[model samples]
Target chain A: MPAEPARRPTLDRVLRIDQATYDAIVEHARRDHPVEACGMVAGPLGSDRPVRLIEMVNAAGSPTFYEYDSTDLLRLYRELDDRDEEPVVIYHSHTATEAYPSVTDINLASEPGAHYVLVSTQEHGNNAGPVEFRSYRIIDGVVTEEEVTIAAAVDTNDAAEEHS
Target chain B: MAIEVRIPTILRTYTGGEKAVNADSAGAGTLSALIDSLEANHPGIKDRLIDGEDLRRFVNIYINDEDVRFIGSLEAALSDGDQVVILPAVAGGAR
Candidate 1:
């Protein structure tokens, strides 16, 4: 038999967060000086998972940190399950570095259902606005970054266009 | 009862910059209580370990390096020398 065909993602809608939510996340990330910051986005349950909120989670991070905790992921899952919602995507911020996945990051994403969204807050020793939003997916231990297109919170288009 | 708690890198800030914090004995002997004692002394570190009553989304507390989800969560017990390490959910590009 030929190799298994690729499964195209059917992402019909993308949800954006208001300025308030954005500020909340940035503040949270800044509070944790050196280690990485993590959180999630969610909205009304539907065919298109709406990720509209960013909840800053806590971690046991050290200066030489490698991995992030998954306790909050489980709690998010349970909360959504109880509220009759679903996980649209998973998000985290890189405070001291670009919003890209490190080597350890790829090795840890065993789940394919969630999309990893990274925010490049790298200051490069200078202060500037957050650069961009990047995304990724890990399959069979291989990681592939995806491009995400951000739009107005009320825009018909989603924050992401396609998956690679 | 004296218990040994394994601390993950992410939350080391709260334990006075120590890699691992040992308690002669934890208060309630539960994960929540363990964190509570840590936060009470750390002053504002609780927000980093938990979000409200729920543990932070990206972190995990393993009893002896095994996933607590597959076992038991906050209710997971502690012995005289049990080890609890906190971990976070991380993902990314090719190495």
Candidate 2:
């Protein structure tokens, strides 16, 4: 018998974020320039879709570090739990670094199921032209970059009318 | 009853590769006690989670999705069926 090839483990590494949600994240990052901005997006449990955008404060208020206010985080989690939702996407911005998870960021990823999004405002200020946005899945101390697709929100009423 | 402790990938080696472990509070019912029991079962795991008396600066511990830092840290109370999660902070920059 021939030797069998080793199969690589597969992970959920693709993120589909709506255009509006994407823009809001960028705006938040720009608004908190020189200081890291951190927040999360909530959605129905088990749904990979990110529907709610939460703009959180940078408790650390440092360009190199960011932490969520403990009380606010607790309140948010409790609210989401009551509504049967979870943080589908946890995002933060890098003011002076690239859109990648730093060693510190990798260490702080608590939600293995949530997509970790990073936006870098280093090259261009929020008022300037370009920004670097990226997403990744940090599981078991491993970081894997993923594809981000900006999807357009579908209007259910418009769709129904067109079909009619 | 045993509390569930979710271990991060970097520290799985201490748990014999188990992603999560059920730890008995042994009637202490406190976060610190829970950690002590965990160390008793999985030797050397306490050092990774704690440095001296306080949690390592880079490590974040959460109880049922709430950060322990804000809830009295190691002194936080624990209840049956509570979930404890340990994660390292991730920051991107020059090594």
Candidate 3:
């Protein structure tokens, strides 16, 4: 009998965000109506937790595309490096589309470890009834949708009590 | 020591599946020169990154997290311990 081929390694495919972080991302998306908004959340190196929310300007300023200002990106990276932090979450908003990674997004994802978050504000403008918010992992030119867990402290405590 | 160039997943085929490779830029310090050196070490890799003396429209090159396009494109300078990253342009979040 022939031996079975080795299985490919699986990529990390889950993202956890707190309520405040989630709300901030949505608000930034809504504020930049029509044009796309992009930003990053930094965390201590090797810690997957995203603690800092950074709002970035859409250099492209286009509805269909987004690009971080090269200068700003460089400065931000340098600062992160100095502080022993890394971009744990890189996010963007799609005004007229669902929250999903586009072909270009998968192509440009350089930080394989960071959670790529996408928010859609197509239905409502600031006054939200329904908005699409999702997270993904893009590694090796492949995109994998991941489960997003809202980590509210009160909710966690309540869930813990129920479990106990 | 040579500068390290990170090869994207789509371009790894040309590098024999190597994720990163080192290229000496002692004689030439510009990004263009480093790319030429990379091509010399790994044939057919330059074609994916360059077209008619210009980088492909969809390709993005970054050195130490700073985009080369904003600095000087192909003329961006290099130094020891510098890291280079190449990626394709992603667009269209629209429905």
Q: Candidates' interface RMSDs, in order?
A: 8.0, 4.9, 4.3
lDDT of 2 by residue, A1-164 (tens): 11222112134467888889999999998988878888888877666768778888877788888877655655676577577677889998888878878777776676788888999999876686688888888776777778888889722233222321
Candidate with best DockQ: 3
lDDT of 1 by residue, A1-164 (tens): 11223222224423344455555556655555455556666544543444456564445464224343455544554475566554455666565556656655655564454566666555631244654456566555554565454444533244342211
| Candidates 1 and 2 compared by TM-score, better number | 2
Candidate 1 Cα outliers beyond 4 Å, as residue runs: A1-27, A43-48, A63-73, A124-128, A155-164, B1-95
Worst 10 residues of 1 chain B by lDDT: B86-95
lDDT of 2: 0.78
Q: Taking chain A by itself, what TM-score does each prediction score?
A: 0.63, 0.86, 0.84
Q: Taking the tens digit of each residue's C-alpha lDDT, what string does model 2 give over B1-95?
A: 69999886568889998979999888888889999999999999999889899988767788988889889999998999999877665333212
Task: Give Cα-based local distance difference scores for all models.
Answer: 0.55, 0.78, 0.77
Tell me the spans in candidate 3 whose CA falls farther than 4 Å from its real position.
Answer: A1-12, A153-164, B1-23, B26-29, B39-52, B58-72, B75-92
Q: RMSD in angstroms, all models?
A: 14.2, 7.8, 8.2
- Model 2, runs deviating above 4 Å: A1-12, A154-164, B1-30, B38-49, B58-95
Q: What are the TM-scores, per candidate, against the unseen true structure?
A: 0.48, 0.69, 0.71
The count of backbone overlaps in candidate 3 is: 1
lDDT of 3 at A49: 74
Listed per prediction, chain B TM-scores read: 0.74, 0.94, 0.91
